[model samples]
Target chain A: MLPDATLADYALRLGDDSLVLGQRLSEWCGHAPMLEIDLALSNIALDLIGQASHFLKFAGRAEGRGRDADSFAFRRDALDFRNCLLVEQPNGDFAQTMARQFLFSNWQELLFAQLQHSANDTLADIARKAVKEVAYHAHFANEWMVRLGDGTEESRARTIAGLEWMWRFTGELFERDPALKPLVDAGVAVDVPSLRPDWEDRISRTLAEARLELPKPRRWVMGGRVGHHSEHLGHLLSEMQFLQRAYPGAMW
Target chain B: MNAELPLKDRVLEILSQVADPEIPCVSVVDLGIVRDVRDGKVFITPTYTGCPATAVIEAAIGKALKDAGFALKVATMLSPPWTTDWISDSGREKLRAYGIAPPDRGTAKHSLRDVPVECPRCGSRHTEEISRFGSTPCKSLHRCLDCREPFDRFKCH
Candidate 1:
């Protein structure tokens, strides 16, 4: 049997991805450049929340903990989060944020594609639904990238700068942990290593299409797969978990 | 595709005629957003977020199923979400033929309304967005500069 810690760890990563990204997108809830875009962002937020719920519930099950999705999401410590480093990075500016989406959405596109075919039924169902959403997200990111890359010179420059800022964190996405080995062997999880090339190609193509050049990959920062994260995540969690912690068992 | 299959196929065939309320060019079934159907029950999720046309879609699906002699049970699953990629190839062609630019899948890096939206009037590709919100929540109001005709461009959402 896969160890309970192993399952929790995996669940944390998936949940964190959805939770962190959803938070970021939620910032645009009212401030989108246009109402249609506003609705679009909101829709994406809804999907991520759904995904977070799914993974957290599964994690609760795998851990044999009596915790539910809310507990898994709200009760976890900062050190326990397993989401990629890319998601926790704050929304610096719209350009910076879209750049983040461009990178992560590209990776997610492939990740979900593989997950949809996983031997595990729940993972497959989750992936199947997520792939459809991510495909739109990938489209949204791509459209924004093309606009920024192919738009006015200032927009192009900003988009490039944004990409540079987030590029190093991209490596964390493919960093495989030993915990994933058992699930991977059972075809329940994707080998982070296998996703590397496709992720690169897709990102490269989008960047190239956007008329933006990728910075030569430098020494990559890593460790989120093992529950280690950047300084940013702690601050984010404090804000998100604040309300819940402040008023325990509060309901809207 | 029709003669060989049973109730599911017939239901899908009829459901395909239920046009997308905003686009109006392709039926919901042909759009492939109908994920599952069992025992005369219909399961569909929206193609766009916060889509207000959901009521109309449910109504259309209900009406179409009833027309086909199936009693209705419809459920909408919002999880995993729906994407334009799920829009069928024929549906996309129908959209383009109806003079609306089709939405690409989410894997795209940028969300640019790059191509000049064709004027639903003269079919000229010199359109510009007047406002992102249009007559409905799922579209942007675009005006074709050439024809001085305003039309709706289905927003990339």
Candidate 2:
């Protein structure tokens, strides 16, 4: 079995992924291409934030630390975050945003579905709720990918380019750190690498249906899992954590 | 001794008056979010884990309890996640009457596609989805083919 410390770290990685992506999506509140799309993105952001709270809260408890969800999220520096690089990338355009959602949600769906059966009941319960939400997220993103990819030439070109830009980061999603091995053996966590084949097949079929080809994998950029993040995350934290940082113990 | 209902009963009474922040037509108790009241605690499982109103609902419940002279803590329990199946029959009526279609229980909650959505306004079975995302996270937009009325649907699950 993995030590409590390692399990807490695992939970932080999961929590950070949701929290950082939630912040990124929330930035589209009033700026999405359309009003409905705007609400949809914000709604997705809300869900991610909610999921983040559960994971972070559990992590704190496991660590026997006094930190709560708010402190963990609002106090952590970018160097302390562990989200995959794909999620922290800037939302380039409508197509690019959808591409990022499509890729991440598909991977999340697979992971959460498996996590629902985790040995730990808290993790399982959270996953049971989250898996349903991510399924809709993936469906929404896939539909848009199809519409944009098979639409006009300009849209198709932009959609493909968006996927190409995001593809390099996909490699990091399935990286299995040696620390995760014990958790995987104990059925407390998933083996990240084992999820790759299924994730790849799902992406390939969806891309084909969208009339788009899978972008070739290039040199992989990986580091976010161990707290190394792109520059975008630092700027994102500055905005999201500003309120709590500026006013200590502030509550509504 | 003062004449009043028990603390649990009083808490329930106050909770019954608390409206869902988004759907103002129904009370939180009627929505089946109030799981239980025991030991000076009001346990609730917020509907739609990501709904923006979850916090608002919790705050509203806390204020209602405090105003009623009950020092009860509102605890959130996610073990058995909230479901539309928990919505009372009166809550369903309120939703339909208020122009939003409640989730169809027979369909699996996770199946977001091909599920038949009826129009709340016209009661027509010919409704089509306009967008999976609606005005809120827990809803979807649909239009009735017959009435041509666009309405919000409380997406199943």
Candidate 3:
């Protein structure tokens, strides 16, 4: 069995991805293009946040720390975060938001599908429940990708631009951290690189249905998985952690 | 009659009165949230991972059991994740009577497909979904073309 520290680190990385993305989506609570979209985005945010809580809570327990989901979420500094840069990108426009969701949800769904069989029972259990919720998220994003991509000229142009901007960060989602090699070998973690072909096929099919072209792969990849992040993550954390930092243990 | 029942049956009877905070027409038990009651413990599962009502339902169940003088601990189980198919037949009837279309059983296979929904108000097959999401996480917004009434349909998870 892999050490508890390794398992906690793995859980933290997964939890941070959900936590950061959930925060980004919650930004659309009252600001989405339409009422239906506002509710949909918020619902998706809630689901991601919920998934984050479970993963973070398990991480805390495994690490034998008194900290919990909230602590890991609110107390961590930007340099300590482990989310991919894709999720931390600002929601540029409705099209941009949908593009980001399409890319990330597709990858997340594939990752969880494999993680459900992990030798780690807690991670597997969380993945089993999470896979169901993420399906709807991926479906929602894919539908919008098709609509916006195939819609009016202005919509198609915006959709293309959105995909281009977010496409660079896609590589980081499948990054193979050497620290996790042992866990992968022990069946406690997934071989994330193995998910690429299936993810590519799924993304290609969706883009095709949307009448959009796949953006060329970028030469440089992001390193958010190793505590490196874009400028936006620091700004995001300030807002997300303010209540906790200002008045410790403040509660309603 | 309540006093004559076994402790487990009595505990379940109390639980049946605990309505889902969001869908007030249905109890947690009716929704299959309560998986089991054993040794003074109530094992339940949330309908969705991020459902806000999860904490609320747990609290309600805890209160219900406490009020009945049963010191039962409410524990959440995530394995065998909750499915819409768990909604009891009577629960389905209650949801429809409340003007919310209950989810079709065994629809997980075709979740992304546009399955036809029957209008709870007029029982018409002519219903169109307004949004895949609804006022709550477990439902979708739909409008009956014939009756022109917008209603919530419990979505297949």
Candidate 4:
């Protein structure tokens, strides 16, 4: 098995993706186009945040540091985050949001399914719970993808635009970092490269069902894994981390 | 029922009376979340990790244990995850009586439409989903065509 430090970094990558994405989705609260959709988005966001806590907490323990999940989440600056670029991307519109969710959750569903049986027991346990939640999330996003793509002339155009805009970032999720190689070999972490084909197949089927054409392959976006991000993430962190940063140790 | 039984058994008995915060018709024990009580620790596996009600359930369990004069730790286990299949038969009956459709047994999580949800009020198979989400994440809102009543159906996980 790999060392605890490597395991912690791997966990942080998983946690930060959920944390950033959950924050993005939470921005939709009180603002989604409809009440049912609003509640659904918020519910999915809550599940992501819960999953974030589990992974981050595990990361904290593995790091053998005094810091915990809250510290890792609230105190870290944008440059320290390791989420994929897709999650940190803005929620452009309802269709864009669903498009992002559709892509990310589908990948997450597959990843968690494999992680549920990881050599690391805690990671495996977290994956077991996460897989069930993400299944619902992916399904929810898929339903919306179909609805918006087939809904009306305007919605169809917007849904297609959403998918195209988010497509470039999809490649980064499957990039196998050298840092994670040992853990993957040890069976303590997922081999991300192996998930690409299944992700592509699922995405192709969903796009076809939605009656939307797949965006042509273009230049792949990169760098969120090593902490370079779009301008949006910095602004998001300022808002999300304000309370914790300003009042260190404050509680409800 | 013997007084000589271990304190853990008494704590379990107490937890059996603690109602689920969201679904008042059933207790935490009946919901199958209370895994065990041993050596001053009360183990519980939350039903839905994302469900807002899990925290409330844990808090309620803790309060109940403390109120019963036990200083047990409420430990949460995420693996061996909780499933709808764990809900007791009595819990299912209570859910139906309370107007919420209980989860159908062995329903596949991906194919939500595979099993028909019977109306709790009229026992009609003519129910339709109004929304995939309900007041809580664990439920889906449905309307019974026969009774013309809208109710929440616990989502089968």
lDDT of 3 by residue, A129-195 (tens): 9998899999999999999999999999999999999999998888888999989999999998899
The Cα error of candidate 3 at residue B85, in Å, is 0.9
Per-residue alpha-carbon lDDT of candidate 1 for residues A129-185, written as tens digits (9 for 90 to 100): 677567767777888899889999989988888889899998888877786798889
- Tens digits of per-residue lDDT for model 3 on B76-114? 999988888899999999999999999899886576789
Distance from true location, Cα of A46 in model 4, Å: 0.8
DockQ score, prediction 4: 0.73
Span of 10 residues, lowest total lDDT, candidate 1 chain A: A1-10
Score residue A21 of candidate 2 by CA lDDT. 89
On TM-score, the candidate that comes out on top is 3
Candidate 2 CAPRI classification by DockQ = medium
Each prediction's Cα lDDT score? 0.76, 0.87, 0.92, 0.88
* Candidate 3 or 1, higher DockQ: 3
Error of 4 at B60 (Å): 2.2
- Summarize candidate 4's per-residue lDDT along A1-252 as a digit string, tens digits: 333888888999999999999999999999999888888888889889888998999888888876788999999999989899999989998999999999999999999999998999999998998898898899899889999998999999999899999999999999999989899989999999999999989988988998988899999999998989999899999999999989988998
* Interface root-mean-square deviation (Å) of every model: 5.8, 1.3, 0.7, 1.3
Where does model 3 exceed 4 Å of error?
A: A1-3, B1-6
Show the colliding residue pairs in model 2: none
Ranking by lDDT: 3, 4, 2, 1
> Arrange candidates by TM-score, highest first: which order?
3, 4, 2, 1
What is the clash count for each candidate, in the order shown? 19, 0, 0, 0
Q: A227 in model 2: Cα distance from truth in Å?
A: 1.1
How well does candidate 4 score on lDDT at residue A6? 85
**Residue A141 accuracy (lDDT) in model 3:** 97
lDDT per residue (tens digit) for residues B75-120 in model 4: 9988798788888899899999998999877673543564668999
Model with the higher DockQ, candidate 1 or 2: 2
